[model samples]
Target: MESGKYIIVTGGAGFIGSHTVVSLLESGYSPIIIDDFRNSKKFILDRLEEITGKSIVSFDFDCSNQEKLREVFSTYEVHGIIHFAADKAVGESVLKPLKYYENNLQSLVSMLKISEEFSVTKFVFSSSCTVYGEPDQVPVDENAPIKYTASPYGYTKQVCERICADTAYASDHLRITLLRYFNPIGAHPSGLIGELPLGVPNNLVPFVTQTAIGIRQELTVFGDDYPTTDGTCIRDYIHVCDLADAHVRALESNSDEEVSIYNVGTGVGSTVLEVVNTFEEVNGVKVKHKIGPRREGDAAQVYADNKKITEALHWKAKYTLSDALKHAWNWQKNLDESR
Candidate 1:
């Protein structure tokens, strides 16, 4: 048990960050949450306590504020950090590039500076597979050449990874691991927490779930002319729990390399149509959807070649696509009932 080893999770109240906090508690590590509630609700902190039976230690502030963040370091003997605070919306990024750049990059740089000052050694960065942009091939690996990103969101992730790598190179103590995630869907099976997007959802699963539950009138399949199995875009939709568990593994795993990179995903691609069909079949609900024009900054087909993370951190996605959709529907239903 890492009894008193306090790991700070920025954006800890958000969807993936909340789940990772649960994972951290289950693994016997004390996690302190830092969030601004810019894109998340405050009630999630209570849910975390409800799930874990532990009073969470948290601070409510944007991590980009260096002085406020420094206070956390001064108070607690911080052991490590898992940075997940960023404005993550591909389509929105195309519309508001400045918002993405300012919030995403500034938060990352602020966190990095705090880590350096506090001498927090182990760092896990929440990265995205969108860094690959429109890959030259399907099932892109960690070794794939990072081409020009399609959106400002992806550009921020790419730049953040570089910043972490360069920081690791300069520092003797900081060891950073960049986990490039593919699409993450599903909710906690307990239905206690899930992806709760504030406005219109930028991701497919939440929008699909909302459509099923009647919050959204219908779903829109972004593009049907892409060069893929069903002409719709394909993604590697791993369960959010599986993705959250990978963070714990990445934090626990040891390596001689200062900056390590891994692709955290199921090594398979499911088309947009497949996801919709599977959701209907598994949960006994139909999602009314139409073929809309292609969304900007979308890749034709992007999945993971996840052999490296499997071997290095002993991490592999456990939940199936059908299971993910089923859980997603259950979460949506749960939210509806609560309201």
Candidate 2:
């Protein structure tokens, strides 16, 4: 660990970023949160303090802004960086490819340039499994081919991974770990902070929670026509807490490789129907859902192999899918209570 031992969590007030902040603080690291509050809210920082019992160091700014990025670097002796500040909606990316490409790529490029310039040795990029682009095989391994992405959001991850690799290949001091995470669901167990999407949710768990809470009319199970166990899409839903801890593990793991890419997931595939049923079964909340047509660019089934990350970082997911749903439901309830 560097002297200051401060980690810069870009997009730190958002879903995964907020949970990661909790893990970072618990694991003996100071986190400096930088977010533009476009997809997140300022109240989340307060909730983070409630969860961790520590004042969060945050800056309200976009990571792509070179001046604000410099201010963060200069203000804090940043030893490490976890880049999670990117536009991440698949459907939105499909409709607005330019916006996805611009924000995702530019923010990452700025982070890399700053890391290289300031000699920030440890960097973790929040990549996604969408880079797989519906792999022909099940349980995608780290060596899985980087197929053409289905959306501009995914394409951004693929390109960012390459950018990190290329930058690491050229720099002797920089070490990059690209964590290709699967579907990350759930919130912090405290109910103080969790996945709170602005407006409608694009992911499954939040939508399910909202519907279960009567915030939304019903949950739409997109594309149940896929050739899966239930004719619905299959994904490995890892708890956001586990995924957050993996960031700390990645930062602390010892690796000589300049750039290491690992698939972070639960190594288990659960269909959309399975997730919905499990959520209802565990939480006793009936989610009125409908099986709709297959979404475009929707994969038949995609989960992680996860052997590489376990062996490399000595990390494995500990929470079950039901645990994620329970936490998600609790978080929704807390949000209602807070309101």
Candidate 3:
């Protein structure tokens, strides 16, 4: 938690990771990045430098590589780790369950081993609201039962949360915080870093951006007959920057607990049609979207009850949905211009 303490951020080049790196530097913490560039690119490092005016140190290493990860820990004076590396595509995870398990589960185990070996106790894990699979009640909370995983990726998060808990229980020195994030949308305010989906995007905001930028044909609003107020799937779409800030706060807390779980979301839910409408309003352009049949493994509605994190960490989502959409639009515009 000290100013000069070296904090290792796995998957630091990715969307949320890059934004968290910016937050870390802004908060006077020195962050060392570890990424394989499997899903992310090196351009994010340059973008981070541009945004924070600070040179970041990064290692092109996979968190699952035990030997290589050990070398990273030995080389750097890593005091804490904010783990963000994982395979996150829900649909792809269903097709490639082993791949998700390997990347998500193995990397987390390796990271914990390294953390224990090197005596780096402070840990912040990137968990997901998907762990609360199809909550029986609206506005799901931290105490909500971790239902059956909708996809392999969601199962990985649930597994990792258990791993963190078990690891902490065995080791009295370890302090782990699991942040169950809801749908993270938008980009950094500087428009230098944003969600860069490879090939095609599975998330809604990126698909909306791609559609607006003409990279994709149109946005497909999956399932228009869900049992929601709008008859469309509703999700608590938190801003990426806001989600990133939660990591910094968690890392700084320096608690001695085995594991603490918090839902990182705006206690509000927005439907798919509502998001598209907001995108159109924010960009001042109509989004070509169509209501499609419900995709397999898709949930009807999922929003967070972010009271625990708000009270425990004193962190609340500051940006509104309008702000998120505006930033996302700006990033999309920048992407278009660069292309």
Candidate 4:
């Protein structure tokens, strides 16, 4: 990646995309965002500019539109493309598999076609730990077998990974980096921008925040009968800022390899109950929660063995769960203030 080159960030107005845009701008790379606003807001662009002290060029377009994507590439000389646009709700994907496939799979194909046409080789994919399904071990590594997908959304990611690998292998110029991210929580330190989940949040942090703010009556502990320390499901919750930083590193480490996949996580696991306890302790408020049956497509335990990313890109997670919770609280407060 060029030092001051422009990077195209699809879905840059979304949760992980916005935070990654901040990291890219701070690291001296200009980011041009593209989104359909189906799951994001326009105010996020303003917040990004306020944080970076630079104007951001954003396009309100869907990544699945091949013609529009080609028009974008013709208009801008982007050196790299970070594809983060996708429908990522596991439960909803089970309900709407066609929507997930149409958006996730087609958007990736459109982006790859544009990348090939524009000669932009560097591609960073926003993958998830869901690709691993129910891992056989505690801390899963990059080589962990991608078992059968639990939901259609998870299957889309697995398919996209195959698409990236095949595309890279077919061409000598394409360089791809698949950053399989774990749970990304927290907001920017400024708290000006963070995740904005539509309807009820599927993730833990947002649900906890909503309950704290009285949007929801109580949090539902998905399961407590699993075979684990606390019986609740365990996950490696990494800060969004740390996850975003890894994207910048992956973009910079462009090479002619077929495909390079890295697990972006904290190499730590926390139980669902532990997260609720932490939230209550950090926010000085009680989160009304009750243990419920395991949600379908839910994994028992999933974390990351982030040794590959640390050794390859010299990147590691810096913030802890408490720090992430604090930032998330700040972001919640900011959301309240904005409303």
lDDT of 4 by residue, 1-339 (tens): 223588999999999999999999989898999999999999999999999899998999998888888777777778899999999988899899999999999999999988888887799988888889888886999988999877999999999999998998887688999999999999999999999999999999999998998889999998899988989999999999999999999988845576999999999999999999998898798889999989877788898999999999989999999999999989998898889
The global C-alpha lDDT for each of the candidates, from Candidate 1 onward, is 0.91, 0.90, 0.90, 0.91
TM-score of each: 0.97, 0.97, 0.97, 0.97
What value does the lDDT take at residue 59 in candidate 4?
A: 92
- Tens digit per residue, CA lDDT, model 2, 132-246: 9979898899888999876888888888999999999999899999999999998888888888787889998889999998989988788866788888889999999999999
Decoy 1 TM-score against native: 0.97
lDDT per residue as tens, model 3, 245-335: 9998898785667888889999999999889898898779878988889887778988988888888899989999999999998998898
Clashes of each: 0, 1, 0, 0
After superposing candidate 2 on the true structure, give the runs of residues whose Cα lies further than 4 Å from its correct spot.
1-3
Clashes of 3: 0
Model 4 poorest ten-residue lDDT run: 1-10
In terms of lDDT, the poorest run of 10 residues in model 3 is 1-10
